[model samples]
Target: MGYNHEYQLALANTEAYWADQADRISWFKKPTKTLTKTDFGTYSWYADGELNSAYLALDYHVENGRGEQVALYYDSPAAGKKEAITYNQLLDRVARFAGALKAQGIEKGDTVLIYMPMIPEAAVAMLACARLGAIHSVVFGGFAPAEMAIRIDDANPKMILTASCGIEFDKTIAYKPLVDKAIDLAEHKPEHTIVFQRAMVKAEMNRDGDLDWIEVQEGVDPAPCTPVKGSDPLYILYTSGTTGQPKGIVRDNGGHAVALSYALNNVYGMHPGDVWWGASDIGWVVGHSFIVYGPLMGGCSAIFFEGKPIKTPDAGTFWRVIEEYKVNSMFCAPTAFRAIRKEDPEGALSHKYDLNSLKWVLVAGEKLDSSTYHWLSDLLKVPVIDHWWQTETGWPMTAPMMGWDNPSEARLGSTNKPIPGYDIRVLDGDGNEVEDGEAGNICVKLPMPPGVAWSIWNNNDRYVSSYLEAFPGYYHTGDGGFKDDDGYIYITGRTDDVINVSGHRLSTGEMEEVVSAHPAVAECAVIGVNDELKGQLPVGLIVLKAGEQIEEEQLQTELVKMVREQVGALACFRSAIVVQRLPKTRSGKILRAILRKIAAKEQYKMPSTIDDASILPEIEALIEARGAI
Candidate 1:
């Protein structure tokens, strides 16, 4: 059957279809009911099943006699480290760590805080939590003591797992000092602080509450995986904290396993022994799902890369890793490709490596412009799949389900169609379904699939108000996009990203798309600033390709004319500033809100997730210069 047949079947009987999908995993106690709606306006999946996420990810492969196969390929160019751990070795480490955690009074439902860089121990810590049935909350290593303190206060973890230092670009930051400061700032302090010496940065440890990480595991023995109810939470991953306080997104054991298992095999078209690399930081949801858990549980080797796309060596870092590992499929952000293209305009770096091993390229996190998509696709001669999902949804909600029988051609700039278990729709202001080409709020129909979050930590009412209340029974995605004729989705940025110029709502994504199509422009971001006359007007920030330069006045004129021709003059697009780089979060999301705040001269708090805090002053100076012009 084709896409239509499978989609229709899923739509007709979603519960039964999802039930069949759950059968792909090994459940200790099989579930009788697939889905049940709670009174609080959320759905629970695989309620009666019993299983362990760690066992599925580690033990199953070793038990099947694939002991010698590599499970994690550790490469950290910044830290000057490289190693490979097989499935059997990984299982031994995980079980030993679980036993150590158990010795420290960690029970099944306890919480553990993990604050470390993209190291193998980070994955080991997460899996140890899973093996012992504890809920692990991993804070990004770059976060400040204040930011880390907030999550610490919320999760109230019994233990904090961190390393001596984190390697970022050319600097090594000691993590123990930050952990100590956060513990002081937090209302609740963790009982124990486990410090691993990665950088040998000479970190101070509290004699009473701190323990050396190596000491804890010296005499520990491997422990058996602990089974949990299907509804038991696997982990709580916090949002990147772009807006208000971050919401703790909870993913359960059984549903998460089932959904991701199906996604890894069916959606991405991978099987056992395939090498899938998700080039993302482990702090984010993508890393947790695809990089560590999803691929491992799907019976494939997941690459844990500890390096950046450009600064690690050159623009060739990604290709080198792929060639070195023979990576079958890979995932990265659009920003990464933009940076690489900016550095290597001739694509000479890509020519050096034999990228024939790559089957496809998967991109998410932001809208993938048609220009960048074509640029990469033309070079690799492989299909580029741009999928869309969020921190709340644990897996891909909409992606090109490349079939085993008859695959569909990937439509450029479209985020494919809704995946099997999601009933996605675009709705108008009044909550009615919009026309095919009209942009509206993107929402998922009620009783969201299993892999979705249970609630926003302990704030159920906030979860209801934040997602459910906005669209009634639908889960409001806070995104504004339109569906094409063939059911493909064209995401037009977030709902707040829409600018009203003279009462005409225009998407920054549309303007950015036009600007990116410029031959000289490698990447661009568009935002609306206070126009005083038109309510708001679009201003573009353009980053040119390497070794390509044009007169500033001429560039602005061409971009203004292009926006007028494409989006019409009501866009009032006039200012286009050439910048060295756009300010973005660590996860590579452009800080448009920060840009808009700077343009309007309004007081705005700097987000802790910003990749480079120095970029903010640079943006301010650029805006001031543009205002003078």
Candidate 2:
């Protein structure tokens, strides 16, 4: 079926359409009621169904004669390791770990917090929690103790699973001390902490509840998959909130399984034996959906990578993995490619390996700029699709359906049309629809499709006020963008990213598109800074390509001219600052919010998710040297 036909069918009869999609997965107790409205004014999918996510991801595939198939290819240049785990092998580890958890008093519906690095064991720990019908919350390894404490208080898990340390390039960050500090700071502490000891570092076992991972599972019997209601919570992923506190977004079992299965087959065009690599950390939603669950559930080999895009020995690591594992489809953030491009401007490193096996490259987590998009497309000669979604939505909200007979054409700055089951609309502040090609608040008309977070964990009221209250009868995406006349959707960054110059509203994303087009520019971020007369003005922070040198004054002149020519002088984009690096989250999203805080000289708290906090001071110094706009 074509994209239009499938999309129309979904919108026409959401229940019937989803019910058919639900049948694609192996449900223990198949649901007759597909979609149902709750008292909280939200919808739930497959509410009456029963299934085990871990079962569908592991045992079912093994039962169907895929036992020997490699389910995960663990590649970690940072740690100097490589291992391929088959379905049978992974299932064994998962079941044994589930038994270990069961022995430690973990039961169905209980939550277990997992803080580990990008390793095969991280996948095992998550699957083990799912196998016991327990909800797992994964905090990115190396997060600050205060941040970890906040999550610990929110989830209030019965146990915490962590590794001894996490390796970043040549640095070995001890995880035990951080975990210990968080436990001390948190009001509610777990009963026990299971520590996975790696050879790189050994954690102190002085804590009362500390338990060794291998010792605990030595003689434990493998645990069987426990049945769970479709509406039962699968995981709680915390996304940073504007109010300093983080919101724990909840994902359910049945809908999550069904949506991901459908997405893998249709959205990404993955086959049973294909190698799928999502080069993102397991702490994020992308890793939870694609790197582990989606690929394993769809019978594909997932690459569990623990390395950087540029410096875990150069920009060629990605290509090496693609060639080594014969990866068919890969997914990551656009920042990764920009880093690779900045390091290897001529694409010299990529030529060393065979990347012909890569069919599709999908990027998300942030907007994909036109220059980076073109660079990747030209380098790979494959479909470089920029899909859009958030932590709330587990899968793509907008993407090109590669499985369709006639998918929409890939646009430069657009993320293509809305995926099936998402009724996307561009609306103004008053909640009225906007004209085609006019920028407005992007929203999805309710009820939102499955795989979306049904509610914020332990805070239903907050969920409503945060998403639904902004616009009645629609889920406010918190993003600003427009739909083209041809129906392709372009995301203009977060709604807050829209800056007002005097009275005219302009998207910094659009200005960023103009600035990044310069040949000397590799990656850039345009943020709104305080302006007494104009309300807010846009400023660009640029990182030049490797071996490219231009005087700061000359580069600034060129960028200002480019923005004026492309976005008009009304954009008020006069300032351009050259910086060695931009502060970003570990997930690779440029910390524009923090930059705004710095530019305005407002007091701001250090973000726990920042990849390098030291970069913030460097950025502040550079901005100070440039004087006021």
TM-score of each: 0.98, 0.99
Please provide, for model 1 over 1-629, each residue's C-alpha lDDT reduced to its tens digit, 9 standing for 90 to 100: 47788887888998998999888898888899899886788988998899999999999889898789899999998888889999999999999989999988988999999999999999999999999999999888989999999999999899999999998888888998999989999999899999988754867876568998889887777778999988899998988444579888889998999988888987889888989899998899998999899989988888899988987988999999999999999999999999998999777899999998999999999889988988998989998989999999988888887535665567776788888778899999889999998889999888777799968777778789889888898999988899998888878888989999999999999999999998899898898888777888888888899998698789999999998999898888999988888889999989988888887788888798899888878878987887921
> Model 1, 193: alpha-carbon shift in Å?
0.8
lDDT of each: 0.88, 0.93
Candidate 1: C-alpha lDDT: 0.88
Regions more than 4 Å wrong, model 1: 240-243
Q: Which residue pairs clash in candidate 1?
A: none
- Name the lDDT value of residue 117 in candidate 1: 93
Which 10-residue span in candidate 2 carries the lowest summed lDDT? 620-629
